[model samples]
Target: MAPPLMTVIGAGDIAAEIDRHRPELTEVVRAAYLVHDAGDSSNPHSSFLRFPHRDRSRIISLPAYLGGEFEVAGNKWIASFPDNTRRGLPRASATLILNDCATGYPFACLESSIVSATRTAASAVLGAQTLLGTRRARRVGIVGTGLIARHVWRFLRELGWEIGGFRLFDLDPAAADRFGAAIGSAAGAADAEIVVADRVEDAFTDCDLVLLTTVAGEPHVHDPCLLAHHPVVLHLSLRDLAPELILAAQNFTDDVDHAVRERTSLHLTEQRTGNRDFIDGTLGDLLRGRRRRDPGRPAVFSPFGLGVLDLAVGQWVHDRVVAAGRGHRESGFFTGAED
Candidate 1:
């Protein structure tokens, strides 16, 4: 057989390439969730590696095999360092490796921060759309102004959400201010009023939608009644809200098993309750018409951010870039291979 093609895609190339392929990214993430919920995907719960000497820093590995329109396996190696931002660098960075299913040969190394952010943004938008139940989002709140938050807002706008106002709250007031300016300058956010809240509750109060993307190791938002009306909490930052809040909300997660890990907010809620009883069906169930949120209560969607999503998006990028002749190609990536 001829040597397998291996592609090395950089972050800049990945970003430019995905600009025209975002719709597919959204669809792939949506499909990954459905396939996963349908028991067609292998999503081993992500493994976290913490540094003994480092505070608020760790790396995560998410491995998955998606079975649907996508039938391949891969893993994402991603790291996060809150201190990186203070040093004027990105907080999170990643690389995605896509492998051939038949031969298990690694075929591509794609810059994955963009892919990770895009997949995550897709999940958040999908969850928000599902929870919205056909209503246009008039107001949205976000805690933590970071790359993930920026990507979520971008995807929301691209997905055609008519957000009238935005509230932002972050531990660093400067981050919030910088993000507020960026959000205001987004393609269609010119007319929307963006507020940088002095308190977390100020951001949470009276919002039709909310996203938590903080980098805290433990829960901070202690008040259960804060989300009393329960605007759909896109619990992007796994461990932010207290368990009592998760208990009172109509909880939905990509995978109940995975979400209840690493001492996430959902995990804490399950431990306190001693069961997964509070979880409403997942996004797949809602897509399958098997689940619905109780209108009387607020909704919380915690996606474990499946690895299959990265694989799907990465695989798509590889195929598209190869066809476009855009990324670097190496035919001898494996010296052990013989033609």
Candidate 2:
């Protein structure tokens, strides 16, 4: 006899399943912890696999332990290239492999590029709900017009937020127009309108929620003035916003310890200013109601994509497919029923 064979799915299938099962998937995220210092760094570092790339760069493996009704181990490989934009590609691309804890076998190997995008968006939405108080957010300002931005928009729409309109900006104005058109076409008035901006500052003005999902590695990309106006800012891409913006706010992270260890913009700021005190709370604290948001200070969320999220979502996909007899089962070893 042999351990069960895991089935792998592609990007499109995973994206569709993620859309259909977002709430359940997000619950998994809410339950998991962020793991940093996995011994690698492109952005959010984790330990698992580190493979070299075309230009002496490397793809780091991010693994996490997920416990509960769902028990499993998994890791996602993230490849980085600051020059990917030149080829019309994102700076990072990833793949996920879900493994069985009982047998230590690779059960499923799914294309996780889309998974990465959706989960990141889902986390941002969860963070907003936690920090901003769902009732308080009516409008959202999106600073990037890319894949991640599209996913975030859809997630917010699903939450039934009265999104008054969106302020869209991109290095490529044409890309911004294309994104606006797509959102307007699919969401109709639910998307309200897409307002294009000439600069990052123009986008943040008068918005209740601001989502920064750019590839910039510097802090000044997010002018203090821009963030000073927005009540809640979700730093989805880890370190896209300024340290000044972070220091000025009641900073909350998905995992404060992990954020610090990974040297995200939050960590860098702490190092530069010698002020680790800016960290106000973690998502777990807020979710568990152990901490409450202070209305006077601006709220910020910096979530480093956690492995538990991938495992949870992967488990969901795995179980559903397995129950339907959808994945291929190959023989290898069963050694014994009891060992």
lDDT of each: 0.86, 0.71
Backbone atom clashes (below 3 Å) for every candidate: 0, 6
Off by over 4 Å in 2: 33-58, 82-91, 188-191, 261-263, 332-339
Candidate 2 lDDT over 35-125, as tens digits, reads 2222221224475343345543456677775655566777888776657878988766888888777877787877777777767878888
lDDT tens digits by residue: candidate 1, 71-103:
889899999988898789998989998888888
